[model samples]
Structures are given as structure tokens and as C-alpha cells.
Target: MIITKSREEIELMRESALVVSRTLGMLASEIKPGVTTLQLDKLAEEYIREQGAIPGFLGLYDFPNTLCMSPNAQVVHGIPNSTPLQEGDIISIDCGAIKEGFYGDHAYTFPIGEISEETSKLLKVTKESLYVGIEQLRVGNRVGDVGYAIQKYCEDHGYGVVRELVGHGLGKTMHEDPEMPNYGQRGRGKKFVEGMVVAIEPMINQGTKRIKQLKDGWTILTADNKPSAHFEHDVAIIDGKPELLSTFKYIYDALGVTSTEEDKFRSKAYD
Candidate 1:
């Protein structure tokens, strides 16, 4: 069953979500060539604890990391290691946190130093597809609406939308009802309603959509060995519209970038 949140519950969720956003922002400046993902994981664990929130991913499902650090062809669930990131490599950092018994999950793919023009375009289109999907997350819209939007947007640009992994409803737990896939037919699946909060993420691959699992039983990678990009945001339905519970502002601020893309989804100015 889909668990809807009360206003008070939503507020608590927002606080938890912001803690994750702030953590990602703090790590933004630290992501560079020669930096090990294991090192970044340590930083994230310490920071999440400092904010009075527990690291949501640590020991969850017997997994042993604070963040899912996937680089290059890897799609998601990549474990952190001592391997130092190199120039031109892109890494996706998926984070989660728990505060006031609520869970906040967010993710972003970052480029190390500079990347190839081809990879750059893939990143740009993948992120744009994320917003396209988000635009469909309104009251009464079915889950397929969001997935269809994301699929069409990315496929039009000749990108592959990952099929195996999907986003999920989040509140009090990491995964909940209503699996949000990146590709689907319109007017299908569960109908969205007010007070429903979910993590909408688009994991698009540069080549074939087929994926394979590593022997470690954790990391997932593109079948064709092509690069993939993942972007995510937590959202809630309120007053018949979709409202963002997560923001990339912290990441943008740290990188000295500017964007008003999130203004449309926000009900009020971010404090």
C-alpha cells in the first residue's frame, strides 16, 4: 500500500531531504581527480552524523557503504573503493539519510575535471530528461506518465533508458510502494495522489539499455560497456501539483554554476 504523509510528516521529510542535499553540496567541491570514492564515503558518513541524521545507506540490506559511487559504464549500486578518480571520468553519487524517522534519497552524476564532448551531451540530456519526467508527477497522473516522459525525452536523443532499476516511493523507509520506472506506456500503473512522496530518478545509458551485474553482487553496469548517467530528486504532491523536496542548488553553488530550472517545481522560495 502507498503510505501518504501528513503535513507534519512532510515537513519532517523535507528536513531529512535537505540534510542529504546539503551533504551532496559539501562533497561537490571535494570531487576531483585523485580523490578516492572510499574517501568521499568517509566524508559523507561523518557529515550525515554531524547533522544529527543517520547515514541511510550504511548497513541497509547488508550493504556496507554510505554512498553508491558508480563511475563510467557502471549504472548504480557501485561500492566505494580506494581507486582514485581520474580526469574525464564521470561518477554518480547516490546518497540517503534518516532524520526524525523519515528517509531522504538523492543522487547526481558528476564529471571529474573535464569529460569528452560525447559524454558531456549524454549527461546534459539525461538530466534534462529527469525534469521532463518530474513535470508529469501531478495529482491524478499515473506512474507511467512520468516514466513515458523520461523515456521519450532520452530515447529521442538516442540514449538508452535503463530497464532493470527503478525509483521508488520513500517515507520512513528506503523503498516503498509505487515503483517509478524510466520507461512505460501512458495512462498506466498507479495513480498519483496528494501527500504522496517519491524519488524520481532517470538512469540513462549512452549505448544499449541492457545491463549486467558484477560478481560482487552489487554493482550494475551497461551491457555494452558504454557510459551511463543517473540523476534523482525527491518530490511530493501538494495542492494538486508536484513540489520538489530535494534541490541541486547546493551542488550548483559549490560548482559556481547558476540555474533557475527548479523554480517551477518549488511552491515557495527556498530559505
Candidate 2:
């Protein structure tokens, strides 16, 4: 069953979501060449604990780390390791936090250093597809609307939309009702309503949509050995509108990048 939150509860959800948002922002400046993803994972674990929240990914599924560090051809669920990320490599860092009995989940694909133009465009298009998906989260739209938006936006740009991994409704638990896929037909699936909150993520690959899992039983990668990008945000339907509980402004701030792309999705004018 779908677990909907009241306006009051949604506010609480925002608090949980922001904890994760701030965590990602903090790591944004620290992500660079020669930095091991395991080191970043340690930093995230400590910070989340300092904020009085637990690492949502840790111990939840017997996962050893707080972050899913997928780099280059890896898509999602990549375990953090001691590997030193070098120039031109992009790592998708997926994070989660449990605060006040609620969970917040968000992700961003970060560059290890100065990357090539082709990979940079892949990152840009994937991030754009994310917002396009979120734009479909408004009240009165179906899950398929969000999926279609993401699929159309990325496929037109020659990216492959991952078929296996998907976004999901989030609240007290990490995964909830309403599986949000990146590819689907319009007007199909569940109808979105007020008080519903979900993570709208697009995992787009630079090659074929097929994926494979490693022997570790956690990491997932593109079967064609091509780079993939993943971006996500936690959102809630507030006052009959879609409101973003998580923001990438901090990430942009750390990377010294400026953007007005999120302006339209901000419920209030962003300062």
C-alpha cells in the first residue's frame, strides 16, 4: 500500500532530506583525483552520525559502507573501495540518511578531475533528464509521466535508459510503494496524489541498456562496458504541488558551477 504523509509529516520529511542534501554538499568539495571512494565513505559515515542520523545504506542490507560509489562504466550499487579515482573518471555517489524516523536518499555523479567533453555532455544530459522527470511529479500526474519524460529526454540525446534499476517512493523506509521506472508509457502505472513523496532518479547509460552485476553481489555495471550516469532527488507533493526536499545547489556551489535550472521547481523563490 502507498504510505502518504500529511503536510506536517512532509515537513519532517524535508528535514531528513536536507540532512542528506547537506551531506552530499560537504562531500562535493572533497571529491577529487587521488581520493579513494572508501575515504569519502568514511567521511560520510562520521558526518551523518554527527548530525544524529544513521547511514541509511549501512547495516540496512548488510552493506559495509555509507555510499554507493559507482565509477565510469558502473551504474548503481557499486561498493566503495580503496581505488584512487583519477582524471576523466566520473563517480556516481548515492547516499542516504535516517533522521527523525524518516529516510532521505540522493545521488550525484561527480568528476574525479577534468574530464573529456563527451563524458561531460553525458553528465549534463543525465542531470537534465532528472529534472525533466521531477517536473512530472506534480499532483495529478502518473508515475509513467515522470518515466516518459526521463526516457524521452535521454534517449533523444543517444543515451540508454537503464531498465533494471529504478527510483522508488520513500518515507519511513528507503523503498516504498510506487516503483518509478525511467521508461514507460504515459498515463500508465499509479496516479500521483497530494502527500506522496518519491525519489525520481534516471540511470542513463552511454551504450546499451543491458546491465550486469559483479560477483560481490552489490555492484552493477553496464553490460556493454560503457559509462553511465545517475542523478536523483527526494521530492514531496506539498500543498498540491511538487516540492523538492533535496537541492543540488550545495553541490553546484562546491564545484563552482552556477545554474538557474532548479528555479522553476523551487516552491518559493530561492535566495
Candidate 3:
């Protein structure tokens, strides 16, 4: 069953979401060539603790790190390691946190430095598809509506939408009801309602949609050994539309990029 959050509960979740958002913002400047994912993980842990919230991913499923640091061909759940990132590579950092009895989870894929034009376009299209998916998360829309939007947007650009993994509802628990897939048919699955919040993420690949897991049993990679991109946002239905609980403003600020893309999704109250 889908759990609808009260306005008070939604605000609590927003605080949790912002905690993870701020953690990512702090790490944004630190992501580059020669930096190890393990190092980023350590920084995230310290920052989250200082905020008075526990790392949501740590020990939740026996996962050892504070972040899921997936790089290059890796899709998600890649354990942080000593491997130093190289220029032209990209890494997706998925983070979660719990504060005031609520959970926030989201992800962002970052380029190490200068990347290939092909890879750059992949990231661009994947991120665009994320917003397209988010636009479908409005009242009266079904889960598939959101998935179809994402899939169509990416597939039109020759990208593969990951089938095995999907987004999920969020609240007191990290994962809740109504699995949000990246690809599906419209008018199918559960219909969205007001006060419902979910983490809508699109994991798109540059090659085939098939994926494989490494021996570590955590890392997922594209079957053809091609690169993939993942972008996520925490969204809630407020006043009959989708409101963003997570923001990329911090990331953009850290990276020195200026964008007003989120303006349409925010209200004066959140400002």
C-alpha cells in the first residue's frame, strides 16, 4: 500500500533530503581526477553525522559505505574503493540519510573533468530524461506514466533504459510501496495521489539494457561494457503538482554552473 505523508511529515522528509543534498554539494568540489571513491565516502559520512542524522545506506542492508559510488560502466551500488578517478570518467554518487524519522535518497552523475563528446551527450540526455520523468509524477498519473516518459525520452536518443532496477517511494523507511520503473507503459501500475513522495531515478545506458553484477555482488555494469548514467530526485505531490524535495542547485553551485531549471518546480514557500 502507498503511504501518503502529511504536510508535517513531508517537511521532515525535505529536511532529510536536503541533508543528503548538502552532503553531495560538499563532495561536488572534491570530485575529480586522482580522487578515490573511498575518500568521498569518508567525507560524506563525517558530514552526515555532523548534521545530526545517520547515514541511511550504512548497514541498512549490510552495505559498508555511506554512498554508492558507481563509475564509468558501473550502473549502481558500486562499493567505494581506493581506485582513483581519472579524467574523462564519470561517477554516479547515490546517497541517503535519515532525519526526524524520515528518509531522503537521491543520486547525481558527475564528470571527472573533460569527457568525450559522446559521453557528454549521454549524461546530458540521461539527465534531461530525469526531468521528463518528474513531469509525469503529478496527481492522477500512474507510475508507468512517469516511467514511459523517461524511457521514451532516452530511447529517442538511442539510449537503453535499465529494466532490472527502478525508483521507489520514500518516507520513514528508505524504500516503500509503488516501485517506479524507468521504463513502462502509460496508464498501468498504481495511480499517484497527493501527499505521495517518491525517488524517481533514471538509470540509462549507452549500450544494451542488459546488466551484470560483479563478484562483489554490489556493482552493476552494462552488459556490453559501455558507460551508463544515473540521475535522481526526491519528489512530492503538493497542491496538485509535483514539488521537488531534492535540488541540484547545490551541485550546480559547487560546479560553477548556473541554471534555473528547477525554478518551475519550486514554490515561494520553499524559497
Clashing pairs in 2: none
lDDT of 2 at 229: 95
List clashing residue pairs in candidate 1.
none
The regions of model 1 sitting more than 4 angstroms off are none
Please list all clashing residue pairs in model 3, or write none if there are none. none
| Candidate number of the best lDDT | 1
Give one digit per residue, the lDDT tens place, for model 3 in 1-271: 9999999999888999999989999999999899999999999999999999999999988999999999999999999999999999999999999999899999999999999999999999999998899889889989999999999999999999999999999999989998999999999999999999999999999999999999998999999999999999999999889999998888988999988777777763332
Q: Tens-digit lDDT track for model 2 on 32-72?
A: 88999999999999999998999999977898889999999
Candidate with the larger lDDT of 1 and 2: 1
Off by over 4 Å in 2: 268-271
Give the Cα lDDT of each candidate.
Answer: 0.95, 0.91, 0.93
Candidate 2 lDDT: 0.91
